[model samples]
Target: MTEETAPQDGPDGPDGPDGPDGRAARPDREGGAQAARPAGPAGDPGDAGARRGGRWRRPGPQQVPQPHPAAKGMWRGDAGGPFAQMTVMPGRMSVRLRLTLLYGLLFFMAGALLLFVMSVLMANILGNVKVIGFGISDAEAAELQRQFVEQTMRQLVGRSLLALGGVGVITLVLGWFVADRALSPLQRVTTTARRLSESTLHERIALEGPDDEIKELADTFDAMLERLGQAFDTQRRFVANASHELRTPLAINRTLLEVALGDPEASDDLRAVGRTLLATNARHERLIEGLLLLARSERELTARTPVDLAEVAATVLEHSARREHDNDVAVHPELTPGTALGDPVLLEHLVSNLVENAIKHNAEDGGELWIRTGMLEGYATVQVENTGPVVPAYEVERLFEPFRRLNADRVESAKGAGLGLSIVRSVVLAHRGAVYAVPRPGGGLIVTVRLPPGQPAA
Candidate 1:
């Protein structure tokens, strides 16, 4: 490195010239390590070798995460579909509104493109015009060049718009045909899906072509329908079992009552018989009521209204206060104000059942209680909690069934038909609401009911 030839340092670079990046311009310790710099305006290539790290800039919504090694052979275009995912919106834009919007956009674009093409053609053909008339001389043409261009442009725009009107008519008809043809499959899917039910779940859409998304959708729906059919069958069996159990006691009591009243020797035993018969009748009535509650749960229709949940809770607590078992139980109502969309009568019945059940199972001597009712965002919920032994984990779910109670002995004596929770569930279901029972965190059980608010089913 003689002084004359050794690379000189400049204000912008280092001695041996490490240009702005601070990399060596000359060979490093390794013979292969020297990076050359770009020669100014001359095409000699140099150390502008790579953009060091963080060089290339992206414009929008970064998607730089490297693909997984396991995803070999998958195309890069799997990020999103051409259209948004198919959504089952209860409502959509009206057809007239959509058509008008599309046509308006197309009409504007067609007129603009035609006008641009016509103007370019006219400018090439006619040299210029003077004061609106076509000119021959170069001197006059030079003076009126801008004026002629402006006038010609106006004429071209007008002519192109006329032509565009014709194209617009054709485009509208073609667009309508294409849209209808494309949506025909969707229409078929809609028809097929509409026919689906517990019994008709076997109905399926035929895959007429390739195994596309729509085909996949039809397959998925068929599977869902099959599952529903199985569920309905199971429900039917349960109802049948419950019905048989309910009818037996009624039949026995009816036969016994008739036999006793028929005997002549029974006259002295009439008071005793009457008392026993009354007790039997009460038990029979309760059993029938429980069965009816279970049957009602499977119904799809309900009367709905704007119901005050707090008021219902208050009413239930009052009614439950009169229960023979509730004499010792103190009804503690949180009395939170709430509104729910449901049948007021049914909602009241639901609340009464929950409160009554809590009362029925309470420990002797004025048991503690917690009752709450309140509205949330467009929904309402009611919760009833009581101080009692935490229910067994396994038996909790069964308690909602007709004639199911933790203390089956207490319930079987006809004090309760074990149908209180069942009736609550039926009424809640009829309102398109949900009812569930859970053991409280600390101790005891809490029953909750949630219902939609405002728009109720008629």
Candidate 2:
């Protein structure tokens, strides 16, 4: 048989083609032709492929149905079905509001139950009254008495409902006030906790009132702050002591290395070794200084002066000019008046570190460096963007950590100490500002620093 009309291989082999019911094919009235098989259920084309012993496959990419515009803010289920739309979740209710509503509901329910009881009692009392016959028959007098009792009870229930409604409204207002008053101490605690930082940890809630749960909580918070302050104080001392102890040896070693390298009688090999030792000593010194600066910047700033960011950036640029030239990097500066409240020295260091990092991490060949400083959104801002090796977005955050570098060992890398970004973050945080870095679209990083605006010098 030709390939087009060939009997395809079946699970039962080509000799015996099975029908839909797994029975052997039967011959038609013509005797030579097979009987026509029924189409697969639901007329799915895949069933024909399955009957031919071929794997079924989708013709095109599956499409996902979009939710109806009216169903916005609501969850959707399967497409074009009865359960397509689901109810939107309700917004959160504050504890104070929830408490007030609960109180009013309970009071209103109790009032309703009391009113119901009173109506029952009144009905029974009125029903038992005996009617005296003055001018009518006993039956007529009884009917009049019944009408009188019904009217009196109607008036009683109507007045009572009105009074209960008014009382419920008043209770709701009272409950709201009570909830606010009760939660005031907690609000104080929250505010204090948010405002306190490493520098302001000495401030305490000191909530003074009748001893209650909230008061106890406030006292516990204050005690915790006390311990934190002590720990921070200890840390500050340790950093200071470590800085002093570490600097002396590094400084002495550098002086000795310089003295040895200066000797004219030294052989070329000895001089080369001395120069290498000097470089290593200088790297150690830089490391120590970076560590000390990082620690200091993590602490709270004790002094604040109005420092112009433009001036700081300009100064750092001037100092970094030689390095930029050496690296064959172009400088672009758009300095504007960006004044921030911070220590002048620390602010300068922050700017210097950013500039140095941009230059150091720039492309090996000539690259572009862009620096901008101005007031943005009521805050002084400094932004630095540069062209360099492509930095992964995921690795951007890790660069701020001490001794972290992308694809380079901290000790082996000539890049200074890997503490530049870490110190920048610490200084920004200490000034109650924010600093963040994102990978540039093409290459390098875009680092931005925002600080509180300071009043211009008069």
Name the top lDDT candidate: 2
Assess the local accuracy of residue 303 in candidate 1 as a C-alpha lDDT between 0 and 100: 44
Clashing pairs in 1: 36-46, 36-47, 37-47, 328-366
Per-model TM against the reference: 0.45, 0.73
Residue 392, candidate 1: alpha-carbon lDDT: 62
**lDDT by candidate, in order shown:** 0.55, 0.69
Report the C-alpha lDDT of model 2 over 115-143, residue by residue, as the tens digit.
Answer: 99999999999999988877899889989
Error of 1 at 145 (Å): 50
Estimate the lDDT of model 1: 0.55
Compute the lDDT of residue 450 as modeled in candidate 1.
52
Over 340-371, each residue of candidate 1 has an lDDT whose tens digit, in order, gives 66567667778877887787676555577767
